[model samples]
Target chain A: MTARLRVVSGLLILAATVPFASWWEAGLVRHVLGHVPLLVAAGALLAPRGGRPVGQPTAIAAVLVAAFCIAFWMIPRWLDAAVNSPAVDAAKMASLVLLAGVPVGWAWPRLAPLARGFVLAQLASMFGILGAVWLAAPVRLCNNYLVDEQTVLGRIALAVAVAMVVAGLVAALAGPGITRARPAA
Target chain B: MRSGGLALVAAVVAAGAGLLWWGTEGLSVFTAETARREAVALAPRVLPDITLQDEAGATITLDALRGKVVLADFIYTRCPTICTVQGSDFEQARAAIRAAGLGDDIALVSISFDPEHDGPEELAFYASRFGGADDIWHFARAPSRADTGALLRAAEVIVLPDGIGGFIHNSAIHVIDPQGRLVRILDDDAWREALVLAQALADDTAAAAPVAGGAGT
Candidate 1:
């Protein structure tokens, strides 16, 4: 790719991330934080050149999960009043998964072999944390709080699931691209 | 090389899930469903002009209900609690008055606070459910929000709902004479006062009109 092409590609990658950034601000911080690695990994795929850090297969698998998340997240916004409406308990849960997944698809090129193992580990750990939280605490739902099904704990568990899935998808998709882009020198 | 990255991901996932769950388990909801049954005091003054609504969607001014005993209550059907309770109370009172052979001379009107959604059909349903919903019970619905607001203010009775959906306000039945003037208010009357007021108002109308004195006289 030419210098100009690289720049354009970088821009396309960045533009795709704008919605994620905006959503993060509008009550999606949990999803964003949970899956930050996948987003960074995808950015590395089309923009910067980051060599594989570890188990690339794990991260790559995470990328596919991320893509699925992005597709699902768009569903709610699409169904509403062309912009905003129909905010239900179900929509909130769906958003958590999407926020975590999109970054993996977008940044696959950056995450090499280590992505798969990393994602699996993250998901495993998350489950433990969520079960503990549920067992230890009492839950409540209110109108203002937009977390998963209106529970703080549910939101956390969702965020963890999304992050792991996104990471795996990214590493799986970005490996080949990263290998091909190796310097001619 | 990616060992640190994997560890970071795991740590975050674990911590976030754990903390959020713990927080949720501690949450409790607060609910309120209380409503005031007693009437609020108000000073006497010339009744405000209100273009009351009739059952047929026609505009009937307050003056129209005059020259007879007018019994009015503020109600809304969506009101899952208070309106139903008050309405049922009003209906029982109406039944009692009728059983006493005093239905002809008195008029019962129920004006809805939620004018936008509660129309003729909704009002009719509420009336019909408890019976005595025909000509004698005028289920009035305001044409607009402004009209409802004015009516609430004019009656010196305000009903507001709490966040939990229960209404909070005074429940005083009004006694309006045929002159379109408020003759008196039955404080916290519910149904009992309603029956007495309806009967007394009927007698007032009879005494005022010499033509109806044939049977009662």
Candidate 2:
């Protein structure tokens, strides 16, 4: 599709959807998009035109994390909470739809296994550090990290952000290697 | 690739970005900080499996709390906001215990998350606020941050303060059986009714063992 069309579709979606969560009133699109849009921008910048295609783009990590997020993290949580919380269950659908729309960098060659492993390990490390620090800190300190005892739910949004950043950086870095021979018209 | 397809993908991404921005702003509106739970769904979050320093500076393991129904709440005297609400709620719970006359059987403990600010003296003041029996009503502050955090997390009641005197936290009172196992969460948004429920539970428990026959059977 033409760049113009890509831009327009992206804008139209912005107009059509007002993101909402399940449990409570109102929408949360603005709060999250500040960080999410970077992924889209990264993907669009890394779109390959010709030649061997760069194997990795920063957006690759983002898409991978987002995809994994939908599968492992988000689904179980939604299902678990859906049983007891209408608000959360409702928000789950809205979150899925919105998350589904995030763009891609369209890397052609694909990442080396090392890069993929790095991304995964990085997230685990982040979580580990957060958890460790959280354990050592005061209970009041955790109020910033979470609102309640259910660490799984309270930490989801942050986990998503970290995953995106890690993946987005990978996608961005991949641009140089794959784009050497080809250029999008 | 089809221009339309690429465009479709971009559209999706952009839309996601928009939604994310909206969700963040809207989500925090009534966050726990601003809005409190109307009716608490009290889950029995077990207390940290550690020995704690009592008001007397004695090592009182939760095991030591056995043989008595224990009522536990977390607080820091320095707090001016929700701590006050929580403290008041706790005091009310204690009063309710007294009113119900389960004073001897039930033990009310106000553990402080801020051990530094809530040492024995501060807890004494906090206990003083109620002006009741000091024997059953005891306030203990952890000696270290890790211990305090563990206890608070285990209790599922975290203490967060707004830069100023205001505090933010979850107020779910726990009732433990004589064995120290957390049995029930008190849902007295207003301590007035909570004590009644606590008393009823204690009475139920007391009567349950007696009603069931023993060795002779």
Candidate 3:
């Protein structure tokens, strides 16, 4: 990675951990939104541009780890802990960036196009399902957030799901060559 | 190579499941709020002996009210929505208890978590809006913030500021046994169920007391 990109990613991490992190503590919508920039920055920093294909075992492991990391944090108890406790909040940030983002980034270019598509489709569906659940839930899931704030987050999650599907379709249409692993130099 | 990959996948799944089970408090609840309610029900706890000021500006401790089943709820007088509903519900429940002649067995208490703003005057005014506090029903506040926090924590009540001078909090009618242990948390609207449970507990206390008195004699 270029020094410029490294510096940019560092700044993004800083903004996410400092201002966005503090701001998100107030509401669920801000909490979900704050995570996006941090995830993007962390993923981008570690994603390989072009490399020999990673072994199928390693790729699958990385994807599973990423999925588990995301799902674990989405649980309401953990989410509440992240908001209420500074130690848990710091652990949340670290695990998201290191455990989820880093592995997903490393595995993305190595996976076959079909595998990549499958991952994206699964993510979109998960978000959609979670959105519907949050929207329709009778009880507030998180103690720190009010019901209205949860509803807003549900809408945003649905929107994000749609956007992910669109982005995935566009990527697929753009052809396999774009993400195909290159022979290692 | 395929077998090794499958093993790795299996291990990851197992680990994830274990973590989730732990996080959800033995897979009993997905939300912390539910976990808290379930935890209290599973292991009824004796509340801290926090001092509170009644609407009449008299100091009282939770221990002082022992030997009568207490139906308690956390409320702030200034709440715009659910607290009012709870207040009315408490009034109806109080009337129901009195009508049934279970008034001596069951007691209702509304503890103001927002003690900073809900002083004795505010509590009294709020109580007056709902037929006023009597021997059966009382409106009280923990005069100190620390005491309020301790009471809330003991009751597993979660309260957060709504950023508009009001609070967003979980609402429930907590049922405490004659022994002062918080045994059940019923939905705010389930005051009927709360009454039933409190009456049963009060009866048990009554039954046990005579036995203890006989043994002492």
Please report the candidate that would top DockQ against the real structure.
3
Rank the models by TM-score, top first. 3, 2, 1
Error of 2 at A81 (Å): 12
Lowest summed lDDT across 10 adjacent residues in model 2 chain A is found at A22-31
> Per-residue lDDT tens digits of candidate 2, residues A98-120?
43334233432355556565655
> Candidates 2 and 3: which is better by TM-score?
3
Report, for all candidates in order, the number of backbone clashes. Answer: 46, 39, 0
Candidate 1 residues lying further than 4 Å off, grouped into runs, are: A1-185, B1-44, B187-189, B208-217
Span of 10 residues, lowest total lDDT, candidate 3 chain B: B149-158
Query: Which of the two candidates, 1 or 2, achieves a greater lDDT against the reference?
Result: 1
Residue-wise lDDT of candidate 3 within B1-217, one digit each (tens)? 7788778878888888888788877877888788778888899999998888999999877788898899999999998899899999999999999999988889999999988899989999999999999999989999899988888877767798887888888889999898889999888999989998988898888888888989585
- Please provide, for model 3 over A1-185, each residue's C-alpha lDDT reduced to its tens digit, 9 standing for 90 to 100: 68568657756675666556767567687677666446645754655555666567778788888788878888988888788778998888878777787778777768887788788899899889989999999999998788888898889889999999899878768755644656546
What lDDT tens digits, residue by residue, belong to model 1 across residues A80-156? 21112335323433343244433453345456545546556765565546434533434211112232422444556
Each candidate: what lDDT? 0.53, 0.53, 0.84
What digit string (tens of lDDT, one per residue) describes model 1 on residues B1-217?
Answer: 4776566556545554453333233222120001111122233334666776655676766677666677777777677765677777777766766677666667778877777777777776776777736656788777778877777666655454444665545555777766666656664445676566656766766776786655655
Model 3 quality (TM-score): 0.88
Local accuracy of candidate 2 as per-residue lDDT tens digits, B17-52: 554434333344223222222112334345666766
